[model samples]
Target: MTLDPPSTVSTTSRRGTATAATRVLGVLTIVMIGWLGVFGLLLSPADRDQGDAVRIMYVHVPSVWLAYLAFIVTALASAVHLFGKSHSMQADRVAGASAEIGVVFMAVTLVTGMLWGRITWGVYWQWDARLTTTALLFISYIGYLAVRGLEGSRSQRARRSAIVGLLAVLEVPLVHWSVRLWRSLHQEATVLGTDLDVSLDGLMLFSLFVGVVAFTLLFLWLLLHRSRVLTMIDLSAETGLDAALAQRRAEGGVTA
Candidate 1:
């Protein structure tokens, strides 16, 4: 059966997912992105070594960081859905939302990294440990999202995807540590390295920090809206199914 349009859905669903707080969050995300563009793209000083090529790191670093954070959130939400006392569908929704966002950011990380690599290393692609593991990480989450799209009851789909999510997330640590674990062309962490010493220039560091904060805010905003959208979609489908079943029973002269 086809799902009803949002306009035709029940009053509770009609209220939609937006709120004053979400509106404020959306506004804040926009403002932070604008600030990041100024500082990260324009104002930040170019690296003496990498020159203007280094500016891309402001976006690339934050994208990978947020991708990791999003996948971690997905795993946590999936765990809550599977093992928590309530086993709430809300957790499943959050897991799906976070996974989708993680995949998008992962794609961003790969594209930006390839561009930067071409500029610095004279190649758009490499078989380096970090790059190879990162490509695998991206493909794994794509599979996770595909699993979520499989046909089943909500709980069944959630359980299947949850298991995959937990398994898929194990790859994150491998991707993060690949540089150190193997002979890779990828550079080790700068700001978040083992040494704890910051190697970037003062203004560049601040701009990178802003990029992180801005992307974090954007992720939160997107996650909130996406999860609510998933909730409404499920609710609408269940409502439509119930209505169809009721009509079929009426036509068959059956009583509940």
Candidate 2:
């Protein structure tokens, strides 16, 4: 009889998820973050209105932008997983991993915003329209992640979570427009505004630009590692199940 190798034994040959590309990204992310810190903390002048508290923008804006970008990626990946001819589970893994990173970035955005609020608005919490919508967006994605954790076959989980992911991402646009749709205490976009005029000092603009680039690189680095980790996890689980079933069959034959 031909017998398959043990799952654990099969996986033992795989050392880790890291590759040359990931190592390069890791190095680039570290270097960019270092430059971001220098430009944000030392090179850029403080806002005339917000003072040193404005430094928080270096992190805050980039965090929210990355959150938006990550969620969009999750949605796109989900769509491909759901509708594409191949129905690839790789897309599902990407969706879940991106959502996880998005949640983390969203959390960072909220925390930094709160810190900025404490200094400028005199309170760490508010019911402002933009803040409220952003919180909801964060919670909705959290729910998406929870749905992904539900018990099911990989395909089943992927199908249901794909639906949820597509729906959850709808909130992103709402959160973005809430500032303009209502009288929000939250400030409107400066660089992203409809106006062509950007009033930020050259150094401030450069610092903010650096922050965005650094955060984007960080997100890519995280997504690459996370998706690969998820792939390994799925492999281990499937192989372990196969091993268990084979063992059960062997036992039954022996009993017979």
Candidate 3:
């Protein structure tokens, strides 16, 4: 039996329902992010040395946090898709969603790192260990996503992407330790570093915390939408393939 795609009205209703549910959360996200920006920009005291340039931390730090968070999620989803008895398509959708989000955030991290670098290091880019590993991490996931686009069965695509995703995750730890591993202009970790000897003051730290929270919520919302879209796209592709095959079979029967 050929299963048609949902009627436009049905699709619209579902989308409307999703929008309504996310509406309140979206508003809160915006409000919190706006407040964080204002607080970081206007109220927070500047660093004695970097002065106003330090304002970039609110965005850059959150970007890195969310980027790492997204990749971790992708790796988990990929693992489930690969190893679970059911080998669920749902897991694949989730992995794709998180990878897409991760790539965007990683790109943002790179760009902001460059801008921040220009201010603190007097250059937009350098051969620093952290910067180099971070760039590799970004490119590796880009390849992960690219693998999904290759011609193959659903299972085949999932298998390849799963392996790529799992391997790509190793870079996260390396990037995190790049500072401690080698002398780099990039500052060592604030929260994860062994030393509590951090430089961020109370207000600056608070703003950064707010940034992470806000971006995490944003990632959740976006991930929900992205996964749903990926599911629909896969379903549509499968349906079209089925329909074409059915049509060809019918034609051959008539010809015989």
lDDT of every predicted structure (CA atoms):
0.89, 0.89, 0.84
Q: Model 1 compared with the native: what TM-score?
A: 0.93
| Candidate 3 lDDT by residue in tens digits, 1-256 | 1112223424335542245446666878898899888888988889999998988988898988999999999899899989999987788888988999999999999998899889988999988899999999999999999998889999899988988988899899999999999998788898678786766799988888888899998887778777767777786688788888888989888532
What does candidate 1's lDDT look like per residue over 1-256, in tens digits? 1112234445465556666677898899899889989998899998887899998998999999999999999999999999998887888899999999999999999999999999999999989899999999999999999999999988899999999999999999999988878988999888987789998899999999999999999888888888878878887799899999999999999985
Candidate 2 residue-wise lDDT at 9 = 33
TM-score against truth, every candidate: 0.93, 0.93, 0.90
247, model 1: CA deviation in Å? 0.9
Residue pairs clashing in model 1 are: none
Select the stronger candidate by lDDT from 2 and 3: 2
- On residues 118-193, what C-alpha lDDT tens digit does candidate 2 reach at each position? 9999999899999999999999999999999999888999999999999989998889888878999988878877
> Once model 3 is optimally superposed onto the true structure by TM-score, how far is the C-alpha of residue 8 displaced, in angstroms?
9.9
Better of 1 and 3 by lDDT: 1
Shift in Å, residue 128, candidate 3: 1.1
Question: Which is the better candidate, 2 or 3, if ranked by TM-score?
Answer: 2
Model 1, residue 74: distance off in Å is 0.4
